[model samples]
Target chain A: MTLWLSMLGEALQAMSANKLRTFLTALGIIIGAGAVVLMVALGQGTQTAVTKSISALGSNLLIVRSGSAQQGGFRGGAGGLPTLKTSDAQALLDLTSLNTAAPVVQQGAQLVYGPNNWGTQIVGSTDAYLDIRDWTLQSGRPFTDTEMNSGMRVAILGQTVAEQLFGSADPIDQSVRIQKSPYQVIGVLAQKGQSMAGSDQDDTVLIPLVTAQRQLVGSQFKGTVSMIMAKANSAQQLASGEAQIADLLRQRHRIAEGADDDFSVTNMASIASTMAQITGMLSILLGSIAGISLLVGGIGIMNIMMVSVTERTREIGIRMAIGASRKTVLLQFLLEAVIITTTGGLIGILIGVGAALGVQRFGGIAVAITPQPILLAFGVSTLVGLFFGLYPARKASMMKPIEALRYQ
Target chain B: MSDIIRLAAIKKVYDTDAGPVPVLNGLELSIAPGEFVTIMGPSGSGKSTLMNILGCLDTPTSGEYWLDGENVASLDEDRLAEVRSRVLGFVFQGFNLLPRIDLKANVALPLVYQCVAKAKRLQRAITVLERVGLARQVNSLPPKISGGQQQRVAIARALVTQPRVILADEPTGNLDTVTGQEIMTLFQDINKESGVTMIVVTHDARVAHYARRLVYLRDGLITYDGSAADFQEALA
Candidate 1:
């Protein structure tokens, strides 16, 4: 134990004597580890952001839309037939497997309040829409079922639309013009930031379904809706809920046993898993690129160690003559190499985490600095040093005392 | 006193492209305990090879080398290192001190290999340094000291292990005449006061005179083995 301690002391002294050379030798490892840590953090942060956005869309939610239809010789794309109706949404709510259901009619409109004007999507749905989407009003009350049935000209502004038209002022009770028709703002939705597609989720307006169909979309689409948003009782029930809804829709539409259903249902869980897989691949690719730099760093260590062995040949001879064994000499050199790489690894971690935070704070990139990758990088660097230092340490230890002593 | 070093029929052959080159051939020698012996020869005369064999740094090609009762020629590399650490000390002409460390650490090097505690190692190192009149220079680096002082530090390092035999190869070759004599006088004092076996290898007859017994080698064979006074008389 004492011998090993002395060896360590000797190794440290030797490294300190050539501080500049040691730092230069360790630079490659520093850059390699730093890049690896930062890349992983960014990837993790992006994954978290994606997950947050997906959950904000609502938990265990599924969107049911009308599929394509054939009109004469022309094939109409998704939501073309408008086979979904408010009655179908109401029927889904009766299923015990589903939590709630809302009939939706969506359209883009220019919203104007006084001189402030902003283009936003206008969504028309019943009071249950807020429950399905898990959204709560920042202030004011949602439109009641009575108002929805009566086709009242009342609106609920999204956080983005409210900011554009009202700034910091209270947007409740304010009048906004949509589709050239005046409506009273009843509520302001809380901020939801961006969606997974990078579009602003809060840039929208909401109103009763009857009001949208009668006042904005006209009475031609009276009983039908563009889509139905339904929530499952639990995450595990989402698949069953989609199956039950599809089977019911097929039966209700009276499609033949061999014919295709005219509606499509999408589960949010599948989309989230796919996004997670993509981020996982991205992190692996970044980690591999950083690994190449670590390889180069190992080569640098080997090169410098070889040079050190040659420079200290006479010193090895003297130590051997005095009583140092081959093991002792090897340990000394190996310890020096480990010290260099370990120190470099520590410094790189600090710089990488700091850079990640800087990017998060100033560059607007989400970055999460976790401990797993940091420990992994540190362990890899130390192993790299040991592996690269082996050959040189062996060479130094195997020197013949006579020849080494005579070496200039 | 029993023999501390014994070599019989020792030979050393170096393999080269031209074929085997023999440096030492069938050499025989022995030294009793507490003896001060000098091996003298010109370059390539195998004196250095003989010193290396005696110091346990190298084994003969085929021979029996017994040092202090154990046959060293049969020892493995690790055992040879153990033997060297426990039983022998070496002083070289160039001082061979590590330039980066202080004199005290340099002197304590052997004890470090022995796994001695730091305080005890430094204490023994200082004690030996004082014996060589280098107590004040313990903290100084080897490069900062003069040639004579460096040689003394080397001697102190050799002594710190408290080995039975001290093997020096051209111990004062790099020093001036006065410094060389000073180092030899220190060696003579160490041998007499401690009764330690000393083997000094050098080509300088003046340095050889400091040893009590002189052995001269020529082409790997010992040509003369006698008292130092008789060897001096023969040279005169």
Candidate 2:
């Protein structure tokens, strides 16, 4: 053990004596490790961002939209049949697995407050809409059920619309005109950022379904709804709740057996998993590319170690003559290689983390830096050193003492 | 004193593109412990080959060789290295000190292989360096000192192991006449004071005069082996 330690000391001394060469030799590993770290951080950050956006759509929620309708030989896309209704949403709430349900009516309208006017989505829903979508108010309160039933002109402004209409000023109790009809803004919704589909969730206004149907949408859409948003009791109940809703809707719609249903159920969990799969694959792809660079770094180490072995042939001979065994010589060179790579690995980690933080701070992109990948990179770099250092170290150890001593 | 090195009918052959080249042909020699002997020969006379075999750096192609009562001719590579470390120390013509490390570390190289503790190895190295009159140059690197000092450091490294024999191959070949004489004087003092067995291989007659016994090799055979004074008188 003492001999090994001394050999390690000798290796370190030799490396330090050629600081520039050592640093240059380790550069390949440094860049490789840095690239790996950055790519992983970005991948993790993107995954987190995607998950956040998906959850922002609502937790354990499902959306039921009217399915494509066939007219003669022409078939439309999903949500073209407009078969969903307020009664379907009401019946969906009766399921034990469902926490809440809201029938939705959506239209694009011009919202005007004073001199400012903005075109935005106007969604009409019941009081349960906020609870089902996991939305909270930034200020004031939701409209009463009496108001919804009475078709009163009250509105809840989303963060984007509120900013356009009121700026920093509070919009509560203020009057706004939606499609030429005056309405009182009851509350402002909290910032929801972007949805899973990459659309801004905060660029809309909410009003009671009856009010939208009676005042703006006209009587033609009185009984029907654009979609229904249903929340399951928990994440685990989503599939069963979706099944019960589907069975109930099929029966209520009086659809024939084995026929395509008039509505489509979209599970948010499924969308989330698919998105996670895509991002996970992307991370692996990036990680593999970075791994290739690490392999190149290992080759760089091998090349330099070969040169070192050749240059120090006489030194090795002297060591052998003085009593150093082949094992000692091999170990010394291996130690040098490991030290170089590990040092490079550590530096790479620092640079990678710094780059991640830099991207977060300056690029305005979310970056998650975890310990697992860092440790993995470190362990891989050490192994690379061991593997690449082997051939050169073996060559050094196999030198005959006489031939080595005679090396010029 | 018992014979520390015994070689009987030892032969070394090197395979080359031309054919097999025989260097040492059935050579026989023996040296008792505490004896200082010099082997002198011209280039290609197998003096270096004999030194290499004697130092366990290379094994004879076929022979019965005993070193310190062990049959070294048949020993494996690892055991040969072990024997080299424990029983023999070598000084080369070029000093062969690792230039990056300090004098003390260079002198302590043998003990590092022996797995000696750091403090004790340094202590022994310093003691030997002082014996070679290099006490003040312990912390200096080899290149920072003169060639004579570097050779002394080499000698100190050889002595630090307290080996049964010290083998030197043309120890003063790279030094000037005066430095060479100084190095030879140090070797003479070490041999006379400590009774350490020393075998120096050189072509210089003045260097060979430092040894008590002189052996002359020609055409892979020992032409003369006797006291240095007798060999000098015979040459005259």
Candidate 3:
């Protein structure tokens, strides 16, 4: 240990002699380490954003939207056909693989409370909507079971809708007008940030399903819904849950053999997996680019170390003549390289983490600076030093004392 | 006394692109413990090659070499370095003190290589420096010191290890005549007082007079090995 410390002192002394050259050599490592750390933070941030948004929609979900409509010969787009019904959503919970299911019927409408007014999408769902989305009320209570059965006009406001119409005022007991129809706001939803489609998730309201179907929308088909959102009992059972829903819906609709599904069963896990793949690929790409920079940095260390070894050949010879062994010489040179690279790497990591925080604070881009990436970057830089320092150190150690002393 | 250093039929050949160039051929010599000897030869007489062999910097091409009762001619590179550290001390023509470090660090370096503790080695270094009549400029760098002072520091470095023999290769070559004589006198004093064996190689016969014995080399052969006083009297 004392020998190692002594060698370290020697390394530091040697490096201190050529400050400008040392800084220039270390600059490559600084930039490489900084780039690696920063890229990993950004990549992990993007991944977190995707995962958060997907999970906010609901966990292990399968959204069933009406396939299409045929009015004689003129075909309407998907969601045009009123194939899904509120009862179909409730029936899905009977399967053991499935959990809570909620029916959603949405339409864009202008809301007014006093003079302030805003246009937002109004989603109508049962009380199970909160449980399915794993959401909570910021204040007040959800519409009761009694309100659902009698088609009462109780409402719950999303965060944006509450902010727009009330503007810091208590909105729980306020009456909001949706197209000249007054509804009492009983609860307010918590902030859910943004959805995957770049739409504000909290910029809307939730009203009872019966009130939307009968009082607000008043569709020609009495019990039709636009879609049914169902969650699996567990993430592991999502596929089976999706299959169960498809089978039940097909049996109830009484479709012939080999007929197209009247309603499409879209597994949300596929979208989640696809998003994960894109972000993972992005992380690998950024990491590989950073790896290339590290490689360049390692080569730079090798170049400078080779120069140092050549310049100090006589010094090596002198030390060897006095009794320094090959291993000691090798260790001293290797330690010099490691000290340079590690010091550069430490500074680079601090700067990278600082930059990430700056971006998060000023730019509002979510950047995660986890310890895993930081630790990995440090480990990689150390390895780079050892690998690149090896060749030059070996060259120094292998020198014949006589030849080295004789070298001018 | 048993011999402190012995060489039997030492031969050295260098493989060159031109061909194998023979430097030392079938040379034989021995020096007892505490003996002070000087070797003088014209350029290419293989005097430096013989010094290198004795100092363990280079191995003999074919021969047997014994130092301090150990046959080190066939020792591996690592063991040879150990022998160099424990058995011999070297003073070079250029002082060869590490320039970046202070005088104390340079003087203590051989002991450092031997894994001596910092405080202990530095203490011994200061003691040796004081013994060489260069008392306490421990923090001064070699570049800042005069040629004579640097040579004194080199001598202190050699003495710090307290080896069995001190090898000087043109140790005073870069100094002025007065400073060279002063350094040679210091070597004489140390050899007499500490009973440490000394071998110095120089082109100047005047520097060779400090040692009690003189060996003259010519064409890889020792032409004379006898008392310095008799040799000087014969030349006169």
Report the C-alpha lDDT of model 2 over A1-408, residue by residue, as the tens digit: 777788887788889978998998899889888878888888888988888788888889899998888778888998876788889998998999899999999989999999999999999999888997789999989989798989899999999999998999989999999888899999999999887667899999999998987877767667888999999999999999999999999999998899888899999989998899998888888878888898899999999999989999999999898888899999999999999999999998899899989999999988889887798789989999999999999999999988999999
Candidate 2 per-residue lDDT over residues B1-236, each given as its tens digit: 27999999999999999999999999999999999999998899999999999999999999889999988998877888999999998998999999888999889888988888889989999999999999999999899999989999999999999988999999999999999999999888888888889999999998888988999999888989999988888889
Ranking by lDDT: 2, 1, 3
Query: In candidate 2, how many Å is residue B88 off?
Result: 1.5
Model 2 ranges with Cα > 4 A deviation = A76-78, A112-117, A179-182, A196-198, B17-19
* I-RMSD for candidate 3: 1.1
lDDT of 1 by residue, B45-164 (tens): 999889989999999999999999999987877788899999999999888888888999889889988988889989999999999998799999888989999999999999999899
Q: How close is candidate 1 to the true structure, as a TM-score?
A: 0.95
Model 1, span A58-167: residue lDDT tens: 88899999888766678789988888888999899888789999999998889999999999999999888898888999999999878899999999999999999999
